[model samples]
Target: MSGPKEELGEQRDSTKKKKKKKKKTESGKKRREKQQEEEGVKGGGGGEEEEEEEGEKQQVEEEEVHSSDCIVLRGIFKLGKKSHDVLLTRTRLTWTPITPEMPTGEACVLQPGVMPLQDVFAVKVKRRRAAGQESGGPVLGVTLFCSRQRGRRLEEDTLHLHNASAEHTYTWYNTLKELVSGFSSRPKCLKVFINPSSHKKEAVHIYREHVAPLFKMADVSTDITVTEKKGHALSVMKECKLDEFDGVVCVGGDGSVAEVCHALVLRAQLDADSPEKPVKPVLPLGIIPAGSTNVVSCSVHGVRDPVTAALHIILGHQQQVDMCSFSSLGQLVCFGFSAMFGFGGQSLARAEKKRWMPSSQRREYALVKTLARLKPEYCHLSFIPVTKTTRDLFGHHSEDEDLDQDPGSVDAEGEGTWTTIKGLYLNISVMSIPCLSPHAPRGLAPNTSLANGSASLIAVGNTSRSEFIKHLKRYSSSSGQFSFSFVETHTVTAVRIRPRSQRSWSEEESEGEEGDSKTTPIIQTEGATFPWNIDGELVEIANEVLIRVHPRLITLYGEDMDEAESTVSCSCI
Candidate 1:
């Protein structure tokens, strides 16, 4: 047996060992938990940092590839009167000095010059050799015809860039040619109508000589139809598959052009009226100006040059023009650029009677005869004014803007806005376009616009022969012709004309005294009808006629007339 002191010492030693082991186990568990928490935080943070770094690297690589993809060509170029180092890009041609003049301190540096590819019209390459050194070396030149703006005027300008070697020139030329060729949306195929009887009777010859070659060069395929009889082109247009062709070209005078335009408009309207199909828009019209008076062509092109009109068509340049519809008794008589009654109608009527004579001699004879028999006719005219708000808001707006607006909003019926005038009028002329021609350079209605949805009503009240002659002479002079007190002009959306006298013709009756017998004989009179000069054709219209303008009903191939150029009043006549 052991003593009491020994037993107490053993118990205390065992308790001390147990306490130390428990403390060690708790410390180990805490250390494991701390390590696990630290690892979780570091792993999540590391993954996000790696992803961010990878994204940054990818963005930098993409930027490098984009920069490398841009092809650059550098050369010296002369644009107009200035010379600069040119850098050609895919979308633009930039010019900068080879050695730029550095600005002092914080001053702004010279801006790099830029010309968008859209402005370029044509590009050509030419080779030249030094005098007496032709065999050894050739200098090559690249030329570009581009549309440029100077102040408010837009003009076509030429740029020439010279290179020492032919290889460089050819490379630049090919590049620019490819670029410019892409800018044109010209049609691949066209349906052409040629009126053989139009002025000079050279429409077919003009098409073969001047117009066809250009179309061939532009890679345009044409389906041509030479009209043999009146209304032949109109019949073809109405029956043809319009969707198969990209555009239609009319090679004729204003009459033929008008026929084609009317057919297209009528066809489109006819399609719209059908319940089975959607509306089809009219195809663009290109006029070659092969007529006696190409007023539409001259007005749109600012000149009656056939080649210019052809080039405009080939380049796919287009403009919108208003169309006038003349109707009598709810029947569309015709579509015209300009219309005339009274003296103008008389002149046309007289001219028609002398069609057996040569064109020149007939015109002269008709003018003399009409002037000798000049007399005012009593008539009533009513018109609705184009509201000032509509004119100001939509005058400069484009055809697309007009379409975007509610086209049906305009009320053609006079409603309460009709202004009536009853008087003896020497002449009444209504013009949609300016009606510019070789004879009338400033146009009969000089202030009118092609797509302004308005027409100019020029009324010449009763005046003396000498005074009217003076007014007519002004058309040939540099001074304008519309300043007379007897002349009145107004912009209108619609017009109605009615002659006061219905007794233009009468029947003779003879009564016998024996019984109630009577005999009535119809009298045939030469001047029994009122003639209307529509477009350039004359028609006998004895009753009321209503004329209205359809805004941008047709598209013409040309540039929009510049405000200054249009208003300048050309001296061609």
Candidate 2:
């Protein structure tokens, strides 16, 4: 046994060792905290895209939000064997490599990688799984998945943040979960309608292979309905408890998507118990183009790709869109985005009669056949115009076009003058969206915004057949087809077009048998019925239709982009 002096000396030396170790640990922690306080993370330098708020334009400057106030939690994390300083900010998750200062006075540079919070749809825990085990094992780190724009399309990228401490691993996971799940616009539950008879009849495969996996990765719950018949999607949507989902998604063509949209509008009216006053749908709609004609998807998203559409939905990209209410004979026909009368209606009508032929071939045949028998229709047109923007040539504006307030009443301020005309017209169109496609790259209504409080009423006056073909060919341009003297374009809020009786024809044509009527189709049926193409779906309504433009009545998943670079042209002509 040692003496009391020796024991006291050993105790003092052990106490000194403990103090030194504690001082070193606390100094390293304080150093990290000071670095975080002084040098906050840098952001990705890309310019922020504009966000459409309600119906107004607003810049979101998603990159300018990085500051001390924006930092949520940060620490040292590892990427492979190298260490990195990681930060979770209010708007971004950024990381930079950590390199110690050299003793030789050499300079070192740090480059950080960043991902905006809006683009990061999911964060999951990485675990090491034993053989034949799918559930639990030793904890690894965290994995974050981001959807970003690559060239003309959106692509998915991943980042693995390797950390060994299980407590910190869970702490980062919980923080990210609370932050990402707190986005009010991000859909947590979805009601999806899949049309089995889409373009190639591959809607199921597209969803399972391309769309559903992303939804699963994002932890979004879904209720999917596979449509069986022509109106199956509409019927199913009508009966569905819509409030149970965050949004509605339709995987189909423009026509099917249009039908789904109409169903949603009608459902809203039914729920509101007021069909007379058109009500906006509470849920935003997502369109996955799996069809031959994807006008709505192409026009809104600038591309007709399913993967891009799905990613937009996952990332919560949303914009308001205007809608049209077509009321004829004191009855609401349906709601749509676009409508066509006269020659445009005639082409679609002929195409409908030849459904046995393939879709492309049938359209070509209808175009050729309609051109063979092209004739002018006598009509009276009336419109209430909206004020023109700088981009528009002729715009008539109304002072009482508030989206939240009822658009039924007109205000005394800047009330538009009602314009009326009676003439022989070749074609007429009412469009709220630009109706962009590969054939019409600049859109059929190039000057129109997706949520502008007006619609474009394009009226083609009577012209020679060759001249009319030239006007039709102009759709494949970077502007609206308004070059001809016969083409009249007006930005209007309300339009009433009535087809006049053709006194030039005999009563035998009107009182003829069904076979004769079918063989010799009337150019414009007077008061009895008239063919109109509403969002690619053919609708026949008698007398006149009152088409009123409702601004920001529906929400869609997309952003505003420049007119698509059209590479395809119409060979049907």
Candidate 2, residue 204: Cα displacement in angstroms equals: 2.3
- Screening candidate 1 with a backbone cut-off below 3 angstroms (N, C-alpha, C), the clashing residue pairs are none
What overall lDDT goes with each candidate model? 0.71, 0.79
- Give per-residue CA lDDT, model 2, range 190-227, as digits (tens): 99999888767888898999999999999999999998
- Candidate 1 Cα misplacement greater than 4 A, ranges: 1-72, 75-86, 90-174, 274-280, 387-416, 502-528, 562-573
Q: Taking the tens digit of each residue's C-alpha lDDT, what string does model 1 give over 141-177?
A: 7877665555323355666776656777788899888
The estimated TM-scores of all candidates read 0.66, 0.78
Q: To one decimal, what is the Cα RMSD in angstroms of model 2 from the true structure?
A: 14.6
In terms of lDDT, the poorest run of 10 residues in model 1 is 505-514
What local lDDT does model 1 show for residue 492? Answer: 88
Candidate of highest lDDT: 2
lDDT of 1 at 506: 17
> How many clashing pairs does model 2 include?
5
